[model samples]
Target: MIFIPLWQRLLVALATVAAILLALPNMFYGRVEVANDARASIAQGLTSPELEADAGLWPSWLPSGLINLGLDLRGGAHLLAEVQVSDVYASRMDSLWPVIRDALAADRDTVGFVTREDGPPSELHVRISKPEGAARALEIVRGLARPVASLSGGGSSDIEVRAQNDLLIVNLSEAERAATDDRTVQQALEIVRRRIDEVGTREPTILRQGADRILVQVPGVGSAQEVKDIIGTTAQLTFQPVVQRTSNKDADPGAGNILVPSVDEPGVYYILDRAAVVTGEDLTDAQPTFDQNGRPAVSFRFDPQGARAFGEYTGAHIGEPFAIVLDNEVISAPVIQSAIPGGSGIITGQFTPEESTDLAVLLRAGALPAELTFLEERTIGPELGADSIQAGKNAAYAAAVMVVLFMIASYGVFGAIACVALAINIVMIFASLSLLGATLTLPGIAGIVLTMGQAVDANVLIYERMREELRRGASPVKAVQEGFDKAFSAILDANVTTFIIAAIMFFVGTGTVRGFAVTLAMGVVTTMITGVYVSRVLIALWFARTRPKTIVV
Candidate 1:
């Protein structure tokens, strides 16, 4: 039978148990309580949007205020989004172009110029009287191009492209030297949060670091698909024609006699509008407040045109009600009690503080250009998450029992050595996760189970090799050495492929896929170490002293 030194074996067994204990507690997350002040510190920089985006970020359900569950353990939704930076860059460039245009046109004497007049967002055409002088004018526009160095990739390569002649071409990066900072991933995170604000989330946590990838955490949200819809779609708000408002025909302040078209179903409402007078583009802020009659309501303010139209409409209508609608649904209708002079006013109606707060959040985040449909939805309650975790644990325990029994029964003593090392590999995986602050998802657990199987894969190869060497009449030491040597390449290639797949999962996949990918990656790495290397060391030391010839065979 395979014989092992007691001291070495005991040391490994203890280490394995300790690693499991450290990682076991984190499998489920619930609540933690702390002093109010500590909780307050944790609450720092946590805004409504932040809290709504990440329910975990706030000490909402946790009275202890200590630890919270991640999506993996707690069973929350995960989202993946491919961000587009072109729109944001084009917008910023468009805004700055006006300032540049004014500055250049002001110094007309410096260089004679003819405006291309009509040009795309980034493309400008100009005919200069003195072609040589156009370069100086170009310098002014070029001076304004600081190259948006942001955390998101959108603005990183964000340089102002100067086309030949008097034309200013604003292509991102044509040269080999591209600026870096705000990677597309960071931009996506921020943009997604903003969009979530527009739609209002239960609570989400979005963090950004990578160039093209972002991490989004949503607690208590069951629908990954719904979250994706809200965050993924770019709600390009526009002012369309109001064929009907919620109420009857009314005159808008600026346009005179404004009519917004709308149809109300049992619970669902739709406002069919042609063109909009003013959309969310001019909206600045919206808040909930008590009107003059102490009625719960919301107050909104618009930018220049929005303000002017609002003011003129309210002033002229005097008694008619103006509708505050969102996504074609009428939120509130408040009558013109008095003239709203400054482009800011309040909407008084039947609304809870929560509803008002939600409305305010939506407006502040901006609105969708048109209506949206829920293509898909799925919900996972906390109970379901608990059940899933329990089921996973049970399965793991069963699998471990079966694998351990099989390994020892088949190979006798050498098989038992592999089992012990395999156990250590599992423990090491958990320990590493705890240390790394990685969440153990259900998929992650599956990854671990799969890893447990693969953990033995390397050992099996080496053990088989050693057995073959012994049959061929090689010395025990030479068999062991040659077995490890021969199996190295195969293990390397197989594990490397798995590692690459995990990397891809981290990049393209979101939420659960990512969790599985992470655990798989970590397990693969540790399996190589503990399963292949660590197990060999322990076996090597034992064989050196005992010098067993026909080991447990």
Candidate 2:
């Protein structure tokens, strides 16, 4: 330990210097964050002269990473939402009506007239005029069963269509329901992530909870209500062919048609075909742009198949009006002036620039599979977070001071060396956190304070071993070497056991506990480096230059 080679010593020194440099950004986090944001904006062509100046505040080559503060530290919104996954079941059965009707109508001889039977919302019940035809109807419907393509229920049929008495019931099978529930939750999670990211929030925590719930924690957001508004809109966009345009609010729109109120004109309603010509799922991209009238509008491009279908529909119905519906409200009804062969079109409405931008974002993100009910919500104030941060800083300083004073009083010059190593260890911890983009919470700060004591444990063992060696009349260099060698087993064993525990906590814990685990895990690795290798290098250099024959312990 006392005789570290020049190459190894230089490598350790360079690494320590690099870690300190990487951690420097955290000291000026506000400026660095502004600079980083400006740089990103410039990349997106949203740059102005003011933003470019901000970008110059921090050089691009420097380490721009900063430790992300968790919701607890930064003060933001927390929301727990329960997804209504079963709601999709009713719609699924309703959509199967066309397929079932078409299939049975093809074999009309024995099936006779097929009418939908009023039954459970979870099931599709259709009665055949001829009871004897139930078996044949079941066979036709069962032929429509699709293989479940899911991780949970792979290679199984997605639906079960069976004959019960005079009625044929169609519903999702057990395996299929499990698969559907999983998919609904996954899609909801992705949609929520996209919506939040679209709003430009940093480091939002969105994760699945239980079977049909989501936990969202967005730091730096103003309120839980703001986040809820962004994600809760549903924003289901669809294009339907207009059957009739009317001024009557209470007019019967006929079966298979829906009466939707116009968004700009409150009293006017449009009766649109129940089946959609295209949906937002077909959209490939959407951007806020000016229309031909120089008004704010949203232009959307479609995927290949959607583009083909849309182009054909418009080409065939040149002079007919189509309603652009959003969440059951008609945003606009415009006649197809000509065939849009390029698969892109613009949506014009009485929209401001902000509204157009938000709608574009919603279109690009896609729709949620199911509606979410906010079960719990809370907004944390910045004042409380500031207080917590101040308290954490005080605790850390007190711990560092006490540890440093104790080390100085006990081990003299060796204690001073240990203190330097401890300081380097703290820098390394922050560097690691920043590099990993880990969120720092209050509990994580507590972990740092705890690590302050642990950082010097190896030094304590080494110094005591050195005293023992000196008592045996060993030379200073030999005593240092034996001290490090003897304490190696104890240091390695203690750190490894604690590291295992930290790993367990990191894997099993959630939220604050996981944050604590992250800091503790990082601290353990940094402690091993600074307390063992760094301290050894510093002492080795001192001994090599001094060539001391004997030393007081």
Candidate 3:
């Protein structure tokens, strides 16, 4: 019999009801947030200000924060980023590879290196074919490695250049040492997001494109160039010891070729010649305001230790110019006037309100833990979103009408019952998405329509089997029961496979693929439950009440 245990029956009823309830918010009340120009606001999280276009449509009873359709359904920004983890790693390795090659070549008799095309440990092939002085060669090779302070402390490292038979692996180059960490993808995304947020870009869509790429979509953005700038800037801030002043140093001002840039051009910053004494990482807060003399300036606070260090340094260096450098550009170089005991100080530059705000944002976001460079970028706007939504809707309606008509023709009266269940299934799917906050994409709409067509698969299997049973002269009740019983396993196998594919699509696919996959996966699940179990219950209730011995066609 197609009959389920009472518990199974109750569970189905409850699940079906819950799915409907969950999707209610998205279907009715959820509105896609729009930018001031009624376009998609991709980088919404970046900006603090509200755009003119953010409006919500929701049931009066829904919570104020609860209702809003996502980009998946309403056709908002969609981007696919391919994380180039390997690319970045290779580029870094290439930079240091040459240096290591040169070092080894210099000691050709003792050590020479080669790189494998593909191998584990990302090894470099090495040869100690001729050992003029093996110990000295190894020492020089080791000296090539500098301590990776971020990795740990108090240790010096030489580049991993040693002979294992004919091959020696360079452990990691200076550049590669910075690159070898796991979680590069996550770190890259966070840095990109931080840059976007600093720019006050609104509703930005940032997703991992592949293993190493990032897809970024910024809606309500005026210029893609500006968005690109924000994404690309490294903002590598440093604090350097006030280089010991040499008398007459001001005559040349270009000491040792450390060309300091104008403070206004934060992008032009570079490293100072002297060693760093403190860094932006120690900065607690920064604000754009006037100093004691009332000139355009910035006041910065320091950590407990930085405060002590700064106080001593300023106190000793009174009457000497302290360079306020950012990105290697001297925004301000003011002479120490007095011993400021406090951990805080000010730098007043010829500045504007806009520049001040930008600086403030950058400082607030915190400096990137390491430098970052963009390999790729992708963007989609609201105009495209609207067009996609319309196309999706038309396609959906057409698919639905076609499927509904086909079902009626194929199964006659039983098809009519399935059709009613199909409509319920559609409603339940939407309600479930609305509730779960699932995003719907063009592919997702296709999933819905495809599932709609296949919703009848289980019902068709049962009815066809029943007809065969009836033809074989089985009793009507037994024929109906056996039909469902025999078809259950086949129905399960077919739908389960589709669900697995959908799951993979969601996991491996980012952005739109994920949205579509999720919708498809959910739809397959809903169809099996509603199409098979729900329809059977309603049909059984009908037959039991009527007790028809010979069913009319």
The Cα local distance difference test for each model comes to 0.62, 0.89, 0.62
* Model 3 worst lDDT window (10 residues): 33-42
User: lDDT at 525 for candidate 2?
Assistant: 96
Task: List model 3 lDDT by residue over 418-479, tens digit each.
Answer: 88788778777776666564555677788888888778887888888888888888887788
Model 3 CA lDDT for position 392: 82
Tens-place lDDT digits, model 2, residues 383-480? 88888899999999999999999999998888999999999999999999999999999999999998999989989999999999999988888889
The parts of candidate 3 lying over 4 Å away from their true place are 1-18, 27-60, 63-186, 195-213, 218-223, 242-257, 264-274, 281-319, 334-358, 368-379, 472-477, 510-512, 540-553
State how far residue 172 of model 1 sits from its true place (Å): 25
Which is the leading candidate under TM-score? 2
What ranking of all candidate models by lDDT puts the best one first? 2, 3, 1
TM-score, candidate 3, is 0.66
> Which candidate, 2 or 3, has the higher TM-score?
2
Off by over 4 Å in 2: 59-61, 113-121, 127-132, 151-156, 162-167, 246-248, 251-255, 315-319, 337-341
lDDT of 3: 0.62
